[model samples]
Target: MNSNHPPTPRTLPTAAAADVPTFGCVVYISTLPDGRKKGRVANLDGIEHTAGTEREVLQRIVPVFKKRVSECLAAGDSVPWIDPILEIDPQEQKRFLPVHL
Candidate 1:
């Protein structure tokens, strides 16, 4: 979903600034506007920014993208980023693929 551009770090959900993960840089998430339950997927690097209408694709992944980041931090990983869920623009939210290197 994302493009060949750098991620603009805007204000986080709470903190003024946080650290983005190491290898878990990019992320792709989706939502089930129809409200149908489904499975989801994320790379080992914790990058999930896209989804399909499959059992594993799981569309309602948007509301939890930040949670996923939190989980990685809970696992004792150095997540050098913050949850910027509040600043996610609906139009810009679609570009979540092709993470930045």
Candidate 2:
């Protein structure tokens, strides 16, 4: 399998993305085995930023994401309105919201 793309094409509702002019793309954050936090926003052209914490990694990716988007637009590429999607995995539903059932 090509490592260039993610295992799955994560997505979100178009309306949700349209609501925010600058849609929140999928920034996959994971805890590295070394204990350092890694934040990767593939929609931003395969960018992967690592820092001590998720917050710090986010701080680093924001500006970069904006810059890459701007460049894509300037180059006449379609607005990456759909690339970086905000999707919630079913398995992670509990982590996001607990249900009393």
Superposed on all Cα atoms, the candidates' RMSDs to the truth, in angstroms, are 17.3, 19.8
Error of 2 at 85 (Å): 6.7
Taken over the whole model, the C-alpha lDDT of each candidate is: 0.43, 0.60
Query: Model 1, 73-98: lDDT tens per residue?
Result: 68988654545532433422223332
User: Which 10-residue window in model 2 sums to the lowest lDDT?
Assistant: 92-101
- The TM-scores of all predictions, comma-separated, are 0.24, 0.54
lDDT of 2 by residue, 1-101 (tens): 99897798778766543332444455767777888887766444566689998789877877777777667767989755544344534322111111111
- Model 2: CA > 4 A from native: 1-20, 80-101
Which candidate comes out best when scored by TM-score?
A: 2
